[model samples]
Target: MASKLTGTVALVTGASSGIGVDAARQLAEQGAAVALVARRKERLETLAAEITEAGGTALAVEADITDRDQAEAAVRQTVERFGRLDILVNNAGLMLLGPVVGADPREWERMIAVNVQGLLHTTHAALPHLLKAAEEGPRQVADIVNISSIAGRQAWENYGVYNLTKFGVNGFTESLRQELAGRHVRVGVLEPGAVDTELGSHNNATIHAEMLDPFNAQHERLVPADIADGITYMVTRPRRTAIAELWVMPTDQA
Candidate 1:
């Protein structure tokens, strides 16, 4: 039997680690030619090689999506390699949890740059190709899945700026979904709660031990592949269907 994405192409940003890596692999497994975009060239190459060895087509595109030019170039490279783009997973993000009062302004800048600007740049670049794919490619629909967080929907004390960025992602996704509906470009947001990934490791030691560690030890968090499954499910649905938002949380998380 043919796979769900037999003739499609996908580009996943932040593909060097965590959710991005698994998402790219799952997309490739469904027979899509995937392009992995991340700042870490070596990790991207390794993943590309792993996917190839597993009988899937994959390309590594080293790029920092915060830079508009690099983001556009990444999109161009993916299209050039695969001929068309059918899916875009904007998965690059940063989470630095700390009290707003004494926080380093630099952390906020980094989060905003990667979580907000990076997503915007990559989406802007990929939209044209995705619209083209919806019109001309085998599938009559194309998809954009933005990886957000439960923080988007709820506010936490230490997660102030992270919450802001994710909330923005959710809002942008909904607005874009409406704007692109006529074009058959399905836009959706996946909000994941407490995943055991490198996403939280960027925080300083004080915050990590005080804020993240206790929560992690108490909760059975979601995994990278769990979120990947959500991504695949959203993108592989029938052309007549569109999922606007998906929130994935650990069963034990309240």
Candidate 2:
């Protein structure tokens, strides 16, 4: 039997680690040619080799999605190599947790750059190719899966700017879903609660000991593959079905 994505192509950002790495692997396992994008060239190359050894086509495109030129170039490279793009997973993001008062504005800027502006740049570049793929490719559909967080739905005290970025992601996803519904481009947001990824390690030591450490000790966290499963499910749905917004949380998370 053939796989669900035998003729499709997918581009995954932040593919150097965690959810992005697993998402790329799962998509390739389902037979989609995958382009892995990240700043860590060595990690991306290793992953590409691993996928290729497993008999799945993969390409490593070193890029920082925060830069508009690099983001667009990554999309162009994917299409150039794979012929067309049927799915785009915007998985690159930053999480710097702290109170709004006396917080580092630079950290907030970084979060906004990677979380909000990065998503926009890649989406803008990939939209045309995805639109074309939806109209003419074998699947006759295209998908944009933005990896958000549970923070998008609820505001936590130390998660102000991170919350803002994710909330923005949810809002943008909804608007795009509506606009592209008629065009066969399905835009969806996947919000995962407290995953055991490097996302939490970026915080300052104070934040970690005071907030993150306790949270981890209390609640069972999710794995990268868990969120990757959600991503795969969203993109593989039949053309008539659209998973607009999916919230995947650990059972222990409230």
Candidate 3:
């Protein structure tokens, strides 16, 4: 009775809550030892405890992915603990909604740092390990799942800069997918639309209100588990399969 991800090691960023937590849990359930990386030590510890209680191996690694040294260290710790890296779920991101004219530049900066820069830092640090795992591991394949948003596919009125960061994710994923496809390191992007999470809480009152407008909340949205299921599916596929791009928008979305 071998598990799907037996002997695999996965690192999930933004793992303190929301999609990252769920994805990490699911990966662990499938028998991959998980490294939970995030700035929130308390939350990561709680999550790691729960996974350990459930008989899954998990390590809480506190690091801010926005910092290059911290991001690299996080990767190093995972490899040091697990011996190899098989899956990387780059799920950390921030979203701030406001018109470009009246928006605070700081909000835009935060989104760019977490969504674009943080993702780049982690991916850059994990590439060599992932390639090695693909070359020589039980699975003989590796996965990098970049969590993008629907905004990456199209632009919205008040989401200009957020759009920029997510669109950059799409481009980076595509380019990396081509480069790594030859090495059996599968690179993919998961685009989620209107997921049920606290992704908008960081915005100011007005911007937050605008983000929660009636039209946006009227329909059922995806949950963290929903995206987690998708991530699990993407990573569990056999070496012959590579899910290069996945659009996981709600059915109500156009």
The best candidate by TM-score is 2
Which parts of model 1 are misplaced by more than 4 Å?
Answer: none
Models sorted by TM-score, best on top: 2, 1, 3
Task: After superposing candidate 2 on the true structure, give the runs of residues whose Cα lies further than 4 Å from its correct spot.
Answer: none
TM-score of 3: 0.98
| Residue 195 lDDT in candidate 2 | 93
lDDT of 1 by residue, 1-254 (tens): 98999999999999999999999999999999999999999999999999999999999999999899999999999988889999999999999888899889998999999999999999999998899989986989999999999999999898899999999999999999999999999999999998989998887898878988898999999999999999999999999999999999999995
Model 1: lDDT to the true structure: 0.94
Q: What would the TM-score be for candidate 2 when compared with the true structure?
A: 0.99
Clashing pairs in 1: none
- Residue-level lDDT of model 3, residues 196-232, one tens digit each, is 8889777778775656666566878888999999999
TM-score of 1: 0.98
Model 1: residue 92 alpha-carbon error in angstroms = 0.6
Query: For each candidate, what is the lDDT?
Result: 0.94, 0.96, 0.93
